[model samples]
Target: MTSVSSKKCNKEEYSFVYGDEAVSYEVVRKPAVEGLSHQKSQRKIAIKVHPSCEVVVIAPEDTEREDIHKAMMKRAKWIYDALKEFRGHLEHVQPKQYVSGEMQFYLGRRYVLKVVEDADALPSVKMTRGKLLVTLTRFNDGKTSMVRTLVSRWYKARAERIFHERLSELVPHATWVEGIPSFRVLPMTKQWGSCSAKGSLMLNPHLIKAPKECIDYVILHELCHIAEHNHSEKFWRLLTSVMPNWKEVKSRLDGLAELYLNE
Candidate 1:
């Protein structure tokens, strides 16, 4: 195990501690906002990576050296890539894929796309059996930009349907949110789905590639956000009340990054 204490021990900054047996990392940092040093705990377990430019690991006090080395090696690639990519976020903000014959999602179901052109009619989407029929009666310039419009439109339709179904089943006790009005899908690289207190949700289409159980878990997770905005202890209690086996589902979902990581 490891222990961390803030002092000029070796004239170098020691901001982390790791437990060899615990398989977790703890980080130490001085409070950015002033004046709470002695009153509150300065060290905290770092379970997630910050969206910053450095690779920082925080471990519990009294952690072992061997475990700390293993943990660092386990997250070595993530640390390296995150630090490298943190500085180049501006260069990575390109539009989501709108390539022809790309698979899309509709209500957690897979859809093969079919795009058509019409000048007088606006873009519309319909699903039959296993196929997604997209009719865009507008421009056919053969440019990817023109197709992006229709693709974006299709995502909205799918997001709306899924959000409605999930809200109805998951939050039937509430009448405050009413119905989903403006939901959309995006190729979000950060999260699988997100919900707003304003009765809207943004989903990543890649969720369809996950297991059905994981999809349900994601839907239920977002639906619970309607009642609790932040992921507090109260939120977890509420989630557990609705989903007793959520831990198992979460374990499955955590490993699903490979499906969308390549995209």
Candidate 2:
């Protein structure tokens, strides 16, 4: 049995061939469980395809090379499907220039970002008449930067308010969850939300642009983590118990990650 230090990752990146494509992936080892343990065959290997189209294999630190290899092989098909879907998201979303007529999303609806430059107008971002109006007074020097800043701040504020409300609304459903768990909005390129072992949550502000249902899904997913902590069978069961149609919602969200995450 090997003990992995929390400060360091002892495993290196690994790759395996799938059909004609040589897929590459990274392995993130979790610390071995203390005292009681499951059999090697029963040991869980959690495979996740992130919004960034990165494949991550998470297994207990003491897992053997052969077990990890077998788990990867078994999940090869799912990995490929997830990769293709996420890749399509990236390929389909048009790059943003932060200019007028650019498309943006708010609560599952698409809106055109109309950059309204006015030397006398107060700098602000407001949704009006099906358009995201970014009014600016200091637009001459850094027009694009200003638009980005104002929009990002607006999204953060919305996320803070919306996430807390949804968390409160959904907390009662997760009977195992104690009170309201603490959460914060911190933008990340790779994940929509993550939970610490201590039960605090870190959510992406980009999630604010997604539909309210999708937002609820992300929040509920994290709330499940409060009890399960790992992506094991228990975790999935807990998640499914609350959001029976979570798989559908997750797919829908993944399909739009490219658009929602675009700067």
Candidate 3:
């Protein structure tokens, strides 16, 4: 089996493999899905796994190959369990049944989606008094994915606006990072956001449901990646310099993940 090493990856930019178990753990800044990276102790490596994708491992440049492998082996059980849960989640994550008065979450608030059909009206979503009103021209018999897609798209659009506003507050000096190209909302099993060395950032729509501080923390985190591609000491030092209370926000966000990730 190939051993994990401290050698810098030229193509991957940043990666780590824990244990000599032959599992290749590589980290790549990818499109937004639904999960966050978890790291403990001294933060030598961070693991971000999407319910639908492979595990990405990030570590400092000086981490030894064998040590990284050992750490990964220690985490093997947890990784296996997480993937199992992800598979179960995929089998059951059918879109919210578009029944009348179905409960749903939007912007951290509870709202009931009341679906109505009007041939003369284009599909529209609006806050009618206090309820969310969805007017569709036709209900394609039991094609729930369409309704769910519509709702998800609506949420993503709203999230973009809210995310931009919040991110602006956190990284006022931040500029439009280029080359990293494209950001979109997708059903992610395990992360809040991602950033590419090329400069693009992918964010989760679930941020709309999280606390403002948590949202800011995620934004700051991905932005920090623009400067330091790995979870090296220098990268964290930079994060601390910018968001001193990041640890608090991180804890809160981690709790939030447990709460909403089941959906």
- Leading candidate by TM-score: 2
Please give, for residues 1-263, the per-residue lDDT of candidate 2 as tens digits: 12121233665577777777767777777886666466852478888888787878888877886777787888888888888878876776886888999888998998999998788889999999999999988668789888999999999998999999999999999999889999889999979999999999999999999999999999999989889988899999999999999998997898788789888
- TM-score of model 1 vs. true structure: 0.45
Candidate 2, TM-score vs. the true structure? 0.67
Off by over 4 Å in 2: 1-92
- Candidate 3 structure quality by residue, lDDT tens digits, 75-105: 7767666656666646654545766676556
lDDT, residue 28, model 1: 45
- Model 3 scores what on Cα lDDT? 0.65
Among all windows of 10 consecutive residues in model 2, the one with the lowest summed lDDT is: 1-10
Model 1 score (lDDT): 0.57
Candidate 1 stretches with Cα past 4 Å from truth are 1-100, 116-123, 136-142, 173-189, 192-216, 222-230, 251-263
lDDT of model 2 at position 113: 93
Q: Model 1 has how many clashing residue pairs?
A: 18
Instruction: Give Cα-based local distance difference scores for all models.
Output: 0.57, 0.86, 0.65
- Pairwise lDDT winner, candidates 1 and 2: 2
